[model samples]
Target: MITWLTIIGMGVITYAIRLAPIVLLERFALSPALRQALKFVPVAVLSAIILPELIMPGGGVDVSLANGRLLAGLLAIFVAWRTKNVLWTIVVGMVALWLL
Candidate 1:
């Protein structure tokens, strides 16, 4: 019972923390510059999260060609740039990684 209560409490707190920002933002308008800057936040955040794993798969820096994730990432980048298709980029990247 304690474990379940703790899980529910954490869930409620997490939801409230996420929802508070959206609720507050809706009540106030942000500056155009701030909005523009926020537009890059997702990309920047994703790069910060993903680039490290791709460039350094074994927990240490490894930028060599032998890195499967790095090669797969390059393929995904190429597919994304050329086809501009998110689905295809993911599929190709996954298949390339599997093959490598």
Candidate 2:
């Protein structure tokens, strides 16, 4: 039927999308700037997601003691800056959240 045909067509399109990048990128190298930008993309993406959860979990931009997520995020930032350990950062953030 039409629905089955549409599903098969979508499968082919998805496969082509996945294969195209591997086939295309194999013949090229990223420039230095592009490579650096790619490295920062994950940080930028995570910050975008985490910042909202931390700063505005309740839809409004709250910055008070009731905003425990924001304070815990700040503590996590401090732990990351001081020790640069992912484990310690999580522990500190968890403790801060529990305390707050």
Q: Estimate TM-scores for all models.
A: 0.73, 0.68
Clash pairs for candidate 1: none
CA deviation > 4 Å runs, candidate 2:
1-26
lDDT of 2 by residue, 49-74 (tens): 98898989899999898999999999
lDDT of 1: 0.93
lDDT over C-alpha atoms for residue 59 of model 2: 98
Q: Least accurate stretch of 10 residues (summed lDDT) in model 2?
A: 21-30
Best by lDDT: 1
Candidate 1 segments whose C-alpha is farther than 4 A from its true place: 1-27
lDDT of each: 0.93, 0.92
- lDDT for 3 in candidate 1 is 100
Model 1, C-alpha of 34: deviation from truth (Å): 1.7
TM-score for model 2?
Answer: 0.68
